[model samples]
Target: MFCRDSESFALFLFSTDPRLIQTATQSGVGGVVVDWESIGKAERQVGFDTQINHDTVEDLARVRAATRARVLCRLNAFGPTTQAEIEAAIDNGADELLLPMVRSANEVETVLAWVNGRCDLGILIETEAAVERSGELARLPISRVYVGLHDLAIERKTANPFQAIADGTVERLRAAFEVPFGFAGLTLPDRGFPIPCRLLMAEMARLRCDFTFLRRSFHRDTFNLDLRYAIARIRRAMREAFARSTAELEVEHRRLLEAIATADGYFRARCEMNRTDAVQAASQ
Candidate 1:
């Protein structure tokens, strides 16, 4: 149901405040995503960069009322509570439900049957098992799929998850689904630490990504700026990105890999430093 447009990409925002979400939607944000997928995230990502949102079904209803744009509710992983979550989301006005941390097709199939076409169903491909079973999952009648880098980084045990993009993992997952699909997040095109947002957009353009999430940094990085102008700038750059020649795309790809490698090396070094410090402190 989301990201069906091939000619362009949609930007989904994750927030609970109806006023904030309404402002974004009016300023060209494509969709509102209220995330509730925090079931074991704290335990899963103990020391990692993680965001565990506590948006509720009531918040979903409130945001649903605030915008005419599509509203997506990300439920916890497919489990015992999934049916109730699905029913509550739909009853509260979720246009679509996003299932996270999927590992099997049966999980998706069960959700599908329970949903009974009441609303569109989406899945997150963020686990090693999910990647392996992607072809099987893709063949199902899923409304859409998003390749989540956060959970995936924890699953792959990699210091830098963006490496997935450079190493062809994202490409592999991207190839599996013919449905509306997306991965990664975006801030303003000129801004991202370590990996510039421009490089990410070029990669998305090269991959023909249908949509992407608007990172929290998008506003903070470009705050006080006109929202419409910022969205327009990114879209214009995206248009320019789509018209690039193969050689241009290749050059951009290499730059992205270099950026990822630099970030990864730094992150691993920092982790090692922290471990050394912990050992020294313990001995003291």
Candidate 2:
């Protein structure tokens, strides 16, 4: 999973439906990253200082009962209540917590301190400063680094948001990928292809990323057949990559087998000499 090191399908849950977790479980999905704001009510105010009011505990209980999948929380990025929100998530048995819109290593440290070893961390690198310090972020207790494509594209200059996505440092990383996953941010269905979801996914697998979140392109876009097709495309690419690795391993195995056979004759000769020595000792 993205935030988890274990092997299993990672599903991001934003739905209030208790049955969604069950559906994911039935489909062999292994982990979920629940956005706290999704389950919460919007703030009464209009600006940045928004309050989220919802039955988080009730939702969590239902989620817990549904499956043994690793659970993570994507909490509010800013405001007075951010810490409290994170604490609530930790208390609810979330295995990891994603702090979005992080712009500095110091901020990450602050989050780590607040988390107080309660749960693992995942940082969303969205700003210029964040992109620069990505290597440092990767080295932290952070389980994964999710590049917020939307924010990064906007903050960093490009002809357009999609163009920024296409021609960006994120793409560069995708091409020569590494460990620690990156998310394809805000690429909705209306955006269409040619923006490189396939390439992004390919890089993820090449870099050994465990999973990435797929944001809904359209409202009411449940993980239906269209989503299945998208998943299948990425999966097929990964399978082909795995097959190539397997072939290489087989070749190496053959070489090892030949080497073992070559060493066998020498080993038998040494055994014969040892037997002669034993016979001499017996006669003596």
Best by lDDT: 1
RMSD to the native, candidate 1? 3.2
Write down the worst ten-residue block by lDDT for model 1.
Answer: 1-10
* lDDT, model 2: 0.54
TM-score for all models, in order of appearance: 0.91, 0.63
Residue 136, candidate 2: C-alpha displacement in angstroms: 3.1
Q: Residue 51 of model 2: what lDDT?
A: 26
lDDT of 2 at 81: 74
Q: How many clashing pairs does model 2 include?
A: 1
User: Candidate 1 local accuracy as lDDT?
Assistant: 0.84
Clashing pairs in 1: none
In order, candidate lDDTs are 0.84, 0.54
Model 2 lDDT tens row, 1-284: 22222233243544445566556545444466666643322321111112243437656656666667777677766557777877788778788888877777777887888999988988776677777776666556776666765455446542133333334466454333244566663233233233333344334444445566655542234435454444444345445533445355355434433443454455446435655665687699
